[model samples]
Target: MTDQPEPGGRPDAPRLTTREAAELLGVKPETVYAYVSRGQLGSVRAAGGRGSTFDADEVRALARRSGRREPSPAGGDLVFRTGGDLVFRTGITLIEQDRYYFRGVDATELARNHSYEEVAEWLWTGELRPGVRFTAPSETLAAARRTVGALPAHSGSTDRLRVAVTAAAATDPLRFDLSPGAVLSSARSLIPTLVGALPVLGPTEADGGSLARGLWPRLTARPADAPALAVLDAALALLIDHDLAASTLAARVAASARAHPYAVVSAGLGVLEGPLHGAASGLAHRMLQEAVDRGSAVPVVADHLRTGRPVPGLGHRLYRGEDPRARTLFALLEDVPQAAGALAAAREVVATTARHAPLHANIDLALAVLSVSCGMAAEAGETVFAVSRTAGWIAHALEEYGERPLRIRPSGQYTGPRPAQPLPHAP
Candidate 1:
């Protein structure tokens, strides 16, 4: 083993043995020997610690080689070149069937037993309480469009939303040098505000800033039947927090890059807007609605299956059974009959016809039920889910505040033909 005096008279970095390396890499210890034999890893002797040790570079290389692509689950793929696993859960929680890792509390318990602000406080600020601070919706685009007339039509919805929030946060000195407590509070306030402000602004629940209520008119043919607000609020509470999602991961990735609040949130929003990620559920819900309207869920399911596509809202990559979110949301939808029937029929069709399939009915299905029940047009469900998932994005940002800057480097999988001579003849 190669050895030198500790760098700059400082103690040497702790090194791993073949066994230690495997544990650290979440692989068999033999994997270390294989790497060393293949010239992909190095070994060293520890002076200050264990004498038999593996090189840090070798360990990091192994980790990148076996990242999320491996068959391991959420808690498994954790080997890296830098930083300890700071995000491990102390316990799992579920409230109103919504899942959370609250030191040790169940999320369903927290959501059903606690208010939206309480859950927000718990996830972001490390504290929970009833009736947490909430922001008012925007007054800029109130029901009465007061700019004398509609503005020009070229502005994109996504751009308008991002720029508006960025501008709003920029005007506030508080966002800079933000305290964890402050960020959490701002998140609590900004979510509904974003929802309310998306179309207009500065109204609270008392002032009737129910996001679903406000956005309903824009999506549906008629005004909502009132229970929609309850379903939407429940959604905001239930879907607001989770360990990590792809979009949330992207948000955290931006945060790890030390991006400011707007950039981080925008990063998350961008990812969530992707069809394969966070926004998928909302889209799934719309598809379910279409299937239900066809009076038979099986035909819709069959069409998707024939096309080698998935029937959304029925399955999840993580949750094995019905997604806790779907259960929680469906329970909440009991009061909203229109949503409840649609939800039930969708579940039945998926279960009865798609038995061999993985149609587990996730949060998207729940959101769909709530949206239709609330008079939301099928198209707007995805947008609302985006609004809600951003809460989790902010919470992840807060968690990353103490982490080292993002050093997530994935190596290329060199698989193409390495050398290419000139083509002999054009065919």
Candidate 2:
């Protein structure tokens, strides 16, 4: 019934019978049916008959297939293709999305209604109805604490997290197993470990909250946020997860290869450590700070774009519209009271750049400006990015656990002649 003739198009799309199509394409009638099932062609049932009819255009299109492709260079470009459907997914914190779906629950609503503990529990296990703040069995809190506590009290949170996670995985039996239960347990354990080690609230410190404040004795100058505990809680809640990203992809790749939590998570963090990705916001913020400090953000903003370097933090790759995370943080910024100047500079920066490039302040840029203006460290922003992406990494790792143990197989084009010529060597 889809055969509405293209206005003045080929004679009513000549309803060639399957047998006729086979003749036209130089194949058997069964081969014509094979093409239809393989999605290589289309067909419609003949009017008032059991036989299917083929549009002449589709038949001709099939006839044109020469089974040849462009000669692409040997190392194929990396691409993402949905591999297959999965049954179970687990233990991922999500990014600072406006509509963050944490394990299946809506994060924006949860961010407003539930506590971080509530969300963390939900992320670990699907039970959303709140009860106790505790996570599931084989609870690794004491073990994680002991491992981190052994480090010198002066260690930075990032350093501590790295060491702690590495140490925790060494003893965890689940890291070697590709089982979902084990991976899930490791994910649950690592979350607390990372959060526990962040820097204490204090001056010269960009990140501090109750979690951080608890470790303040390590820093020479501790900041005084009267409700230190609240900040930590907020940090836990604020950073948790995000969508699939390059770093997340790296993590997933490692997991798909059956790497342990430490190895897999490290793979992701290593990618995120790249300046072009995770460090983007902090770099942008610092760039803006230099401009502002020199009383030249306006001029620099204009000149930078002209010189080929677009203003950092104002544009995004996917969000052609305003970045939702930026909008949410903008709302959060309204209440911070002390971020007025940075907010003003950011506003001017955003307006100035829009005249040239299609960029919006993504989460990193927004968080950078707000955090810096609110007296956070420049490095703290990227650290938070790592924490947020951890959510998605775990989720992806869990998804991979159910699939066949795979080392991504690809066909390499034969470019080098069978074997290299033997060279005569005089030793």
- In candidate 2, what are the lDDT values of residues 318-387, reduced to their tens digit? 5566666666566656655556667677777878777766667776666666556645567666766666
TM-score for each candidate, following the candidate numbering: 0.73, 0.64
Model 2 TM-score, all chains together: 0.64
Evaluate all candidate structures by whole-model CA lDDT and list the values in order.
0.60, 0.59
Q: Which ranges in model 1 have alpha carbons more than 4 Å from their true place? A: 1-30, 42-103, 136-160, 200-226, 407-427
On residues 169-228, what C-alpha lDDT tens digit does candidate 1 reach at each position? 654466655467667656655565555545432232344444445544544555556565
Local lDDT at 326 for model 2? 69
